[model samples]
Target: MELFAYYRSTSSYRVRIALALKGLDALVVPINLLSGEHRQPAYRAINPQGRVPALRTDEGSVLIQSPAIIEYLEECYPAVPLLSQSLVTRAHERAVAALVACDIHPLHNVSVLNQLRQLGQDEEQVAQWIGHWITQGLAAIEQLIGDSDYCFGSEPGLADVYLIPQLYAAERFNVSLAAYPRIARVAALAEQHPAFIKAHPANQPDTPT
Candidate 1:
């Protein structure tokens, strides 16, 4: 298995954490998103969406998008289950993940920030744009986590991994985390889990660039 990724990409970080948690040995093929390599003809042929976190399966098929890839992983390797068996619990977990992936991540992605700059927005405004969405999203997450060690409880679940990278991204923008104590606590809990720790931006190969 080969996972096409950009180390600092939050979507890629999600897959990386899940793969690590499942003890899967997938090769990490880093894409240089800063260099626009993901949009180049070569990678575009592999994933037409031109996104990071594209996975090439053992059967030589390509899988795109974080949600689909993560679902496939949970199904194919069920040992270390990320989603709970309880129906309501699973739904709530999905809701929390969606709050970050669908609502928060899209607003603050690299492309969105670039578009803001293209529209004559300065760095300060760009930073504020990121912080605003994250602040709102984390406020919801704070209520969702509610002082739990993990987002869903003692065991790390899909919500925890999904939320951590976004928190890291928020940290990059110097977003104040003080308002969401529960979110902060959950992220701290994730740090103690090796799956989440290994996928941290600081631990990635391309971080210092």
Candidate 2:
């Protein structure tokens, strides 16, 4: 298997941690997003969306989208389960994951920041835009994580995967973490885990700003 990824991408980071935790290995193809390598036709052939975190498997098939590829991994390698077998618990896990993936990430993706500049927004205003969504989304997650070690409960589930990446972005933007004690604690615990620590951007071979 091969993973085409941008080292600093939070979405890609989640998948990297997951892969490492499952004790699986994949060839890492680093896409230099800052240099527009993802926009090139050669990379686009692998993913028409021209996005990073594309996973190519042994059968010569490609999997796009972080969540889809992750779900595939969960199905294929269930030994180190990231989900609960119970339906209710799984729903709760997905809910927490979506809160970050669908809400927080899209608001602060590179395209949104670029668009903000296109609309005559300065760096300060662009930062405010990113902060607004992050605080709003993280506030709810902080509350959820406050009562439990993981998203649903004591085990590290899907929510932890999504939450750690969002927290990384929050730190990058210098978002105030004062009000997110629960989140901070959760991310702190996750970082101590070898998989999360090893999969960090700084540890990646091709880390770019």
Candidate 3:
């Protein structure tokens, strides 16, 4: 398998964490988003959406979108299940993941931030936009998650896969996690998890010095 990804992209980061947790090895094909590599025709061919985190499987099938790719990974590699057996628990885990992936992350995505700047929003305004959404989403997640080591449970699962990258994005945007202690606790626990460590943006092949 080959993963075409941008090191700093939170979506890519989520997929990397999922892959690591599954103990799967895929060659990292660095796509420099900053350099506009993802917009090029070459990458567009892989994913017409022209985004990072496109996974080319061993069978020569390409998977796009982090959420879809993650679902595929969960189905294909069921040994290390990301979701729980109970339907209710699985729904709860997916809800937290969606709160990060669908609600929070999109607002502060590179494209959205660029659009904000184009619409006459200054850097300070852009920062505020990112902070506002992230804080609101995380605050809700903090209340939704249990007092477990990980979100919803002791083991790192779907929620942890999504939350950790969002936390990284929060730190990048200078959003304080101090207000969300449960979220902070999960982040602290993830720091010691080998899968999270291995999948961290700082440890990626394309990470800048």
Model 1 Cα lDDT, one tens digit per residue, 1-50: 99999988999999999998888978888899989999999999999999
Which pairs clash in model 1?
none
Better of 2 and 3 by lDDT: 3
lDDT of each: 0.88, 0.88, 0.95
Compose the digit string of candidate 2's lDDT tens values, residues 1-209.
99999999999998998898788898899999999999999999999999989999888899999999889999999999998888987887888889999999999999989998999999999999999999999888876653677566676778888888888899999998889777777777787888888889988989743
What is the C-alpha lDDT profile of model 3 across 140-168, one tens digit per residue? 99989999889988899999999999999
lDDT of 3: 0.95
Q: Kindly state the number of residue pairs that clash in model 3.
A: 0
Candidate 1 runs further than 4 Å off: none
Question: In model 3, which range of ten residues has the least summed lDDT?
Answer: 145-154
lDDT of 2 at 42: 98
| Predicted structure 3, TM vs. truth | 0.99
Model 1, residue 57: distance off in Å is 0.9
What is the alpha-carbon RMSD of candidate 2 to the true structure? 1.4
